[model samples]
Target: MRVPGSPRWAYGTFAWLVFFVVSHVVAVFFPGEDPTGDGPWDLRAYVIFNLVLILMSAVGAAVVVATVRPWGRRVPRWVLLTPLWLGSALLVVRGVPGMVENLLMATGIRRGGFVGAQDISTAELWAGLGINTYFFLGAVLLAMTTVSYVRRSRRDAHG
Candidate 1:
């Protein structure tokens, strides 16, 4: 059980995955609008994408926990850990910057043309890109993670 990094790293990664999925779901489906009254969401796309993301995150967390447990020794090491961690890492890559930008915007340190504003600044544009990039990357990672998880499971069971 002596991994290079703390178990806390794995736990924190798991938490972040969960938080990101839940936050995005809320944002997409239940966002309380800004003063301008238009919502920051697209329910149709949100439901589709979030359904995939939530499933991926759940599976990833299960794999991480199982891999670290004694009973999971029967499972191949890579099967239960690599894809899980990698998917979670990819999410981190996508999410951290967006989170930073949103935090800045929330504090008013970074203004943007959200809520139907006409002119958005360069920094705001970057922030919007960051947010979009996060979601796209998240979906890609989810698909990859699912494939890897299934492949590894099959390999471990048969080999």
Candidate 2:
């Protein structure tokens, strides 16, 4: 079956994945404070966490390229779809709670854990908000892109 292409969606998703990759790189090197007043995770833990984030971003980019390119038609459907599906699930799972918590804190509907926490800087709060926003936007974009790709591919295959 010919794979229907969606260059705009693919490019947009690629851009977001690039942003995610860059953010993870900054996170690994700069190393921000833990919002939960959790004293410093081990260096190994930080390394592992950031590595996973970077890897996931790369996988997302790969999926976008595969879905939009003619060469992807030669690949097995399960191979192309599995990572996209998994990435969508993982992004939504990670994004939603953070998005909600930040929204609540920003609107003054509820105090966050950082509230009343000693030694937590304003920078930390703002950084958390920014990160959460990025995650939420990225998750939504990825989900939409994946759905569009799948629907278009199915239609093209059948028609």
Candidate 3:
């Protein structure tokens, strides 16, 4: 059962989880092919990125589950959810831009400057967009839900 006012942490966590899962699925099944001379896709780099995503996703899930634990019951709501909320927000900022860049590169829509030439594929671009959108939605929803939880906690604490 949710606390009298649990805020929206659960919702936020759920949203992010969806994003993480989708992105992971896409990355794993259909790794984007970058044609841009800027850089080639490296298995090691992808592994590293996946690792980070997995870590964050796990943390988010843990935090959400913790809400049902005794500690979650004892701690102030805002105090409980703040870290997760902040982390989710950070992920949004970091992931969203990377996704956008990847999408652009994949679509061959990236503008050329002093560094002319791009290595991208239309298929990769579509994949990037889907991945990026997933990340963006997940991050934003997570942030919002976390903030809601924090707010509810604060309110309950004072009242």
What C-alpha lDDT, on a 0 to 100 scale, does residue 26 get in candidate 2?
86
Worst 10 residues of 2 by lDDT: 111-120
Which ranking of candidates, highest TM-score first? Answer: 2, 3, 1
Ranking 1 against 3 by TM-score, winner: 3
Give the per-residue lDDT digits (tens) of candidate 3, residues 1-159: 233345455755665675676667577656667522246756767767776777767667666655645566676565556767677768689667866666556555673211333554556556666666666766666666665566665665679
Candidate 3's C-alpha runs over 4 A off are 1-9, 18-52, 65-71, 76-79, 95-119
Tell me how far the alpha carbon of residue 138 in candidate 2 is from the true structure, in angstroms, after superposition.
1.1
The residue pairs in collision within model 1 are: none
Compared with the true structure, what per-residue lDDT tens digits does model 1 show for residues 1-159?
A: 222322434454455567776776676567454422354756565567767877777777676555435576587766765776577567666656656655655556655523434367777667686765665555444544445445545555689
- Candidate whose lDDT is highest: 2
User: How displaced is residue 150 in candidate 1, in Å?
Assistant: 19
CA lDDT of 152 in candidate 1?
A: 46
How close is every model to the real structure, measured as TM-score? 0.48, 0.80, 0.59
Native-to-model Cα distance after best TM-score fit, residue 27 in candidate 1, in Å = 4.2
Q: Clashes in model 2: which pairs?
A: none
